[model samples]
Target: MITVKAPGKLYIAGEYAVLEPGHPALVVALDRFITVSITETQDQGTINSRQYLETNFHWRRRGDQMIFDNRDNPYHYILEAIRVVEALALEMGHTLRVFDLDINSQLEDQGGRKYGLGSSAAVTVATVKALIEFYQLPLNRLDIFKLAAIAHFNVQGNGSLGDIAASVFGGWIAFSTFDKDWLRTVLKNNTFSEIIASDWPGLKIELLRVPSELELLIGWTGSPASTSHLVDRITIAKFAQKQQYQNFLESSRRCVETMIKGIKAAEVNVIKDGIRLNRQLIKQLGVFSQVDIETPELAELCQIAEDYGGAAKSSGAGGGDCGIVLTDHSVDQARLISAWNQHQITTLPLTVFELTGANV
Candidate 1:
């Protein structure tokens, strides 16, 4: 039996601009993770697969013939990862036969929907790891990262590819400009290149489980915004010479650097100030508003958090998803819960994971 676990991630800075060539992004691997396990089937007659969030996949073996049971609209990203494994097995002249595969995922909630906190990337990483172990494939982290990128793009249509790299490498990462065509060519040649790591310091994150004890209150708006849509909008705005948009990107870069320092020093007040400033700057992009971050009900929750001397900002793709708050005063757990109830916003508690590289 082989089992693999991979971490999810959140973009700390340079969200929309990272898709462009020159801009870079800072992302962290979160505590939430996806796990996959694979084992050879003892029945020797059929292969069975069970996956959460979708129909079961089954296949029968008659002599050497393999018959697959199809799933309607199978999660495209997972299928893509399995395809990569199949290709590698074909190259090695080994046919994947009877097997039992199981997948389990734990993700944080953004509003009501599962706003992607790199869940696709985590699944891709876990799939690659499981395949490598089950098939005894001689592939490294870079190879797995590249394969996961292909799978992610197949599902997302267009993505930054930074999330896959962060998931595979773990910890914090700074990605330089990536040219997909160039990367594809390099992969064909079986050659790899080194990337420069920036000097941004790391932060000490404490994982908290008490939902009500959080000084910062997070809530979701009702609107669902697509990451790809936001990227396209930002790209068009950049082409049209929106100076304020350009300024927002530049300021965000600077803010990341400052935030890194604040985290290292454990200066909670400085971190709060940086988050507040960054939220105001992000609002300048015209993508979000105070109302968008919180509904009339959630607005009251924010007011309660603010009364406790905390600041709140949207998490993930924004629109109507999760919002993060920072506070300096003592947390009023009861009041916070009451406020969320009054606003009809479901609150999810999260703990930040310490940054670490992939386990070899």
Candidate 2:
């Protein structure tokens, strides 16, 4: 059996703007993870997940394509992961094998509600990693990231693949999106392996070092938001308000760049200022886009953190999910948590997950 774990991610800065190619964002991998385990089987393959139900999903292979017994199951990411990895394996002169796979996730609450910590990306990365290990593929970290990105983009079809980068790299990362239009053009003229090996235009991923005194705090709003849905709405707004969207992109870029500089220079104040500016920028974006990027609960979450001298903002797409707080070690964490609880917000005890001997 081969087992692999991929950590969930949170966007620290650069939210909607990161969708544009070459625009930077800060994303960190959290300790919460999705685990995938696979073992060879002689008969039909099975997949079980308590997160889904008590039943197990069985599958059959028809010439390297997986055909599930239940076609309507909620395994789009998992199934696509299997297909992409198998395609690469076949290209490497390896025969596909039947395997029983198991998935377990720590990215959710007791009630099985996702914390918006990028569970879908984590699961997809874990599945791809497990399959790569099972087949003994000679792929490096970048190769794995590319393959997982391909599988993830095929399903989600929108948003920056920064979560996939965070899952694959497993640390604080400065990321820029790849040009999807360029990718589409390349895919039309290249093999899967060739495309994986090719340079993706505008893509960038750099691991960052957090200052010793910096502390990250996460708070849940008890409401989940659909990132794709929010992004779609923003896209429509972008088309209608071209100049406004362009201004947003420039401002977000500057804010994220400053934050990245602060991370590199170990300047907490600079980072905090960037976070504050980012909050306002996102508010302006919401006003123009006419989408509630930050809800009342999210505002409360950020306000409490700021009252405690911590810099805060909504983490992801942020109709209502988690908000992140960055502060020095001197802040009163207990008081902050108490304030959040009084407002019905749940503080998530999550820490950054760093890769062992990461190259970047």
Using lDDT as the measure, the top candidate is 2
- lDDT tens digits, residue span 186-274, model 1: 44664122211111112112221222232444454444445555555556666665676677778876775566666566766666666
Q: Compose the digit string of candidate 2's lDDT tens values, residues 1-360.
A: 887899999999999999999789999999998999999999799988898563234577999999864322337889999999999899999999999999999877888777899987888899999999999999998999999888888877788999999999988999999999987787678777998889899999999998989989999999977787799899999999999999999999988998898889999999989989999999999999999999999999999999999999999899999999998976899999999999999999999999996422
> Residue 50 in model 2: shift from native, Å?
1.0
lDDT (0 to 1) per candidate: 0.58, 0.89
Clashes of each: 1, 0
- Model 1 error, position 97 (Å): 5.4
Candidate 2: C-alpha lDDT? 0.89
TM-score against truth, every candidate? 0.69, 0.93
Residue 316, candidate 1: Cα error in Å is 2.3
Steric clash pairs (candidate 1): 297-343
- Kindly report which residue pairs in candidate 2 clash with one another: none
